[model samples]
Target: MLKGLAGLKAAAAKPNSFARHGVATVLVTAATMALGLLTGILVARSIGPEGRGALTSVLTTVQMLGWLFAMGCGKAVTYTLSRDHSAGGRLLSTWTLILLPLAGLAIGTGYLLLPLLLAAQPPETLELARLYLPMIAMALLSELMLGLILGDQDFRSFNALNFLQPAGVAVVYVALWAAGRFTVEAAVIVQAAMSTLVLAAATALLIRRHGLARPDPALGRKSLWYALRTHGDVVGGVITQRLDLLIIPAVLSAKQVGLYALATSLSWLIVSLSSALATVVMPAATRRGRSGRELVLNSLQATFAIGGLLGGGLFVFADIAISLVYGPSFADSALPLRLLLPGAVLYAAAAILLNGLYAENRPFTATLANLLGMAVTLGGLILFLNSGGILAAAIVSTVAYTLVFAAAATLYRHATGLPWRVFLPDPALLAALPRRLLTKPSPVAAAPANPAGK
Candidate 1:
């Protein structure tokens, strides 16, 4: 046991490979996912299904607007910073001066347009949506700082920061639950406060480490171009992710939307495993440039093996899990949960390919892949969403997700010259594997003992 322990330490924790870094990121993601689930349970129980739907509708709307106007700066920042460390200060300066104001403007725009989006929603839902619009500003800036940490490959701090939002919300919800005050409005207010806390913490971290400097016009132009190039992918990706949430309101009753929201919230808990790998893969891909195909392949292999098992388990236990955790009223959410499990896993794996494409300076390929998936989802919803209700939404999503993975895999192959079989993982290894051992940590993923080091 002692020998095995040392072997494990030597293999993963020190050198900061995807094993080391991936474990850290994935572990934190798991913690956050668990916390998020806890928060979801509290919210669902406190408000019941329809109130949860109203809350979800407002939250989803804000997320849609924020990502819609995000301009793809996220991946662009990470890709750029991985290649050039010197741009950190200027990136901070540029975001503060330009991006912050733009975010405020976007929030204002969302407010003016909020009622239109939530028209089908109840009047209270529309009010909640407007109340949540300002949270979009907080989310945008918080994400910007987090992006910089990720771009710098400070996965340690990145993971740490990522943990805080969910953690804070979970704590507040726990308090509210104890006080018997965990209403939908309280949940919304708690989330906004947490967002402000995260943004403030991230900003302080940057200022102490590197004082803000003047924006570099050249760097801003270059980063903004890449951001805009990847912008379609960003917007498309968010649209794809949030479209189901958005559509459930218009086509289904508020109660139905509530059920769908529970399904999705549960789905993300399992899906975050692959997303952790994709998070590590993106910056690592930028660092590897064209040579990163093997990393992407390896991560995808791990994603498939891990995602498949977890998804299957959730599929089998959806009914019990829903009833046990969310109570019997949410039992109906199980079918949609089962339907979403596989498609969500596929979408999670596809993220690795898309990130690789973007990191390799092939944002257009990523953009096309995103648009394809988005189009498929949109078309599927338009033709069949009303006819089938949430079940149809689930089936269409699964199909769309599968198509996206296929398109991304094919495009990834054409772009990187990787064989198709690389998309498949070995069965024997799948049965006896830990993710860190799946691939050697790349040099780009290695960190100094210092968390804030250059």
Candidate 2:
């Protein structure tokens, strides 16, 4: 009986195209959410609101700068490696060769511009931002390695490493707080150090699993060109998504930024399903010649069930959750948290649609859609944020996401001719999810028949 139970667990863990990969990603995403919440709460309690605000600002700035400099190598690496896994080593090497110099330039430029960009911040906060400078290279390299891992389809390692940085930060923060040394500078340093360690681990894993290949100049140029064309989509999407955070420091108090950050983080617990979907869908979609119709449809149905249930739960518990996780000082976060639910759900659907377009080789379509969303989001913030503050930002976010979803979904449907009804949840697929969870990978999916070689 014990032997049989072991076999059953193994079978259950083995996933194929639809339910299996989705389940694994969902589980990982759930863990990431939990860790993020735990860390957020700890940070909030340790430093209080204003410090939390400064920390959020620095972290957000680090990510934005990293992406700006990384030059879209994340997606480029993924696309290139996905197309031909045999070239995985060379692709990884090429991206590393390109990313190092770019990282330096990006960091140097950010340093020069820091005084202007963060002029509103306190001197201490600015100091913390400077301390986080090393993250520029670390964050960029992390992105490149993440793309390689995704392309290699090493979901286990991917999931493990994804959770490590946050978990590490949280643990370190708690220790520092206990030691009475949990200042903003210490926290920032801890975050950067933890992130760098995680990136190093991932790099070691990639090299161990797929030994490095000599960098190919031609392939490197091609990847760089592709990344350049499509990088805007990623940059725009992230900017729109995190635009509110960037804006809050300028227009609102650090305390308010802290509150808004808490609310969005809670709401993101639901919206982040889109990320999980994108992670699994991108490589799979890249493999199939078609728009990955079956995968997208099934994933959409799953997203609806998963995202809807999670979003509804978040909506209902927004107040209690905010209080429990962030303390009563952040209770004001509930209203914005409630307002962000619709956008979160909408964004989840749009993420899948955007990835579908990428899989279909219509990257420009995805880029344009994100640009539209960014414009709407930024314009709304500029025009209404002065009077309306976080609530207005929330409303604008929902509207912006709605427009983005419509644009991307229309393009996907028009290009693929897959009917609107196909995206709707299928009772059969929902029912099959449980069965799929308990079964081994299908022979077809295991063989990776898709031409992309994933």
Candidate 3:
């Protein structure tokens, strides 16, 4: 009977624990989305289109550079730490050592490229990028540390850290706006300051909870090789994701960039859901040896259902939502938002499939799909540049995402032999959500095998 109780406890903990984490991730992501929208509204309304565009460009540049410089160390750290608990300290130390030099290289490159890249922008925008570019190095360290937390599968802390910085920035931005001090520089500075605070807090917690070790060259090489294999895909993915935005300043006006950025920002809510699901999927897949078809299918159904509803809503209410949130000046952003909703959902699906590939230890395969997607994006952008403005950018983005999803899904099939039908949604999976919440675990039916009850 005691064994029965233990069995029940374990089963209850197993699925229920994952369910709880999924629920928390969804809730946190929803809250973060709301907070993010609020921040966008506040910033956009205060700065107008040109200023908002400048701020948006700076932030995007910082993030893209940070991820590029991170060189997949963060992901490598997570993958390594998830599989080998004993090597946590060495993994963290090695990745940190590797990231530092890369960070310097990244920052230097950004400095060299800034003049050429931002020369098209207004002087104010260029100045902001110059001032804030240094922060990406720090952001890289923060991201690596966050990756460590994720490796530990401490979703609670991960969710907290994810929300805290945005929440802080929102609050601080509101205060600054109320005081009539919310210039582009002020907004960017506030974001950087809040992020730094979060980073410091995260670093302290990581050290206290998961202490550090000295760098080991051999371990560093192993992690570096792993990061190299994985981060190529990461770099390609990031480029495809942000290439449109990067090109906007060159071919379009700051106001047009602002409108497009606003739409894209709002559309990322769909992407966020995919990312949240993937957070659970990756570590869970690692444990299961492979991301089985049923598992991936179930995740796909959930993503599609959630994404469909959100994307549908955004499409129908694009005008009203944009007007109400960002004011009438951003009314032009509505069509682009509508255009991006479907693509964002596709992007989300691709992300989950891509994560499945990672869990299967086939990072290089994922790289090919991502590079193909980036190439498509670039080609589409060039093709559409002269004729179409923000609208063209939006449509091309959707096309790029569709092709990327097809590429990733095909590779996933080759890797796992999963059928295409699994990607479709089912009412049964949707119904499972409530059932999981209401049902109680059954007791064990039999005892473990033992000879003579020994």
Candidate 4:
């Protein structure tokens, strides 16, 4: 089994096509979501809202700190590695050296600032947060490794790692529940423990494939500059997804944060699906021609149709689902989940379009687009508190995501000189998807589009 798995990963080392990889990944992502949801329900049921809220706050803080100091290196490494697959060793070494100290710095900084970051919480929450501060490193390593794997276009290995971590988490949660030893602290410990093991396994794979070599000064400089260029969009995109959790504490109660956290967690089920569709897209987009265009177009269509259906099902059945799985305590989460559905699907589509900007070396335009969305969110938050007290923050968030999708689609077309109609799903392609998914890999050649034609 071990040898066969290794062979699979070897065969998956940068495939020339995205079709099978995308479909398989979407399935894997859906399973991960299931395991994740199970773990969440277990934890939420055991801890209740306030305890769950405290846990959520701490976890969010740790995750935010990790991304805060990441400086977009994860995505940057992906772009750099895709351009020079031979640099695996140097890239691995260089990024390892850079992110370790940055992670350490993030841990130190976050430790000092946890008081401020989680100020909305109680003393017990703050103390528990400080205990798990090292999760900052775990989060950073997670991002770096996943980005590298995806950059290699080895979605099979990528899917393996993705599947393992959540599976471990679910197993751990199940074990704890059976043992009657579940608590927020227990949840935190099990998550970090599983993460540590997963990261170790991933690092071992990287080392075996491309043994750690000295960091190349020239490559290091180039990678750093590239990371900086993409940093704004990277950071803005993360903050946009997470800012609501952090900010909700200030305006609402801790319980509301918990409710909103549950809402967002469920909402990501759709976003991750969107994301899985676009998983290989950025790398694929850089390959000039008809194949790249078709790849993007198909991804857009699949994401829209699949994401819309999932989002809609959850939207309509949210109240029952929340109550059925998480009980009446979390039934209130249904409304927020419903409010976030449209935006969630749109945000996923925006993510797909933004790949064009990155591929075109127009990272700043991508950054500007995300920044616009973030600006709307922040501005709306302020307005929501003052004048729209009667409104839910989820409504504002949905509007912000809608604007981001609009901006991203417009920017992607303008940057790539592609027709706007291409941004929409083609009915023919949608109809052909089932047959295509069943067909063998036939990588289409990239024939350049007519320079004079729209």
CA lDDT scores, all candidates in order? 0.78, 0.77, 0.78, 0.77
Error in Å for residue 444 of model 4? 13
Best by TM-score: 3
Model 3's number of clashes is: 0
Clashes of 4: 0
Candidate 2: lDDT over CA atoms?
Answer: 0.77
TM-score of 4: 0.90
Query: In candidate 4, what are the lDDT values of residues 311-391, reduced to their tens digit?
Result: 989998998899999989988888888888899999998888777566566677788778888888777877774444314
Lowest summed-lDDT stretch of 10 residues in model 1? 445-454
Span of 10 residues, lowest total lDDT, candidate 3: 445-454
lDDT of 3 by residue, 1-454 (tens): 6764664444344665666787788889999998998889888889999888888778888888998878777777777777776677777677777778878888889888777666568877887898898888788889788878877888899999989999999999899889998899888888889889888888888877768888889877876777788888888888788988888876688898899999999888889965577776666555444213344445666777788888998899999988898999899999988888888898888888887777777778878888987888889889996689999988988888878888988987777654555556667657786235313311112312212100
- Residue 227, candidate 3: Cα error in Å is 1.1
383 Cα displacement, candidate 2 (Å)? 0.8
RMSD after Cα superposition, model 1:
6.5
Q: Estimate, for each residue in 1-454, the C-alpha lDDT of model 2 and write its tens digit.
A: 5764564344344336435566778788888887787778778898878888888888888788887777777777777787888877888888888888988898888787666656667887777787787789998889989989988867678888988887888788788878888877887888878888999999999998789899999999988887887787887888778888877777688888888888888778887854477776877667654424566666766777778888888889888877876788988989998898887887888888877776766666678778888999989999999999999999888888888888877877765665566667668767776344324222212222223211
- Candidate 1 lDDT by residue in tens digits, 1-454: 5764464344344333656787788789888988988988887788889888988888888888888877777777788888888888889888666577878888889888777667678788788778778877777777678888888888888888889988999998999999998787898888888888888988898777667889888888888888888888887777677788887787678888899889988887666876678987888756654335556666777787768778888999999989999899998999988888888899988988888787667887788877877887888888888888888888877777788888888877776655555567766545544543444533323312111111
Q: What is the C-alpha RMSD of each candidate to the true structure, in Å?
A: 6.5, 6.2, 5.9, 5.9
TM-score of 1: 0.90
Q: If the candidates were sorted by their TM-score against the true structure, best first, what order would they fall in?
A: 3, 1, 4, 2
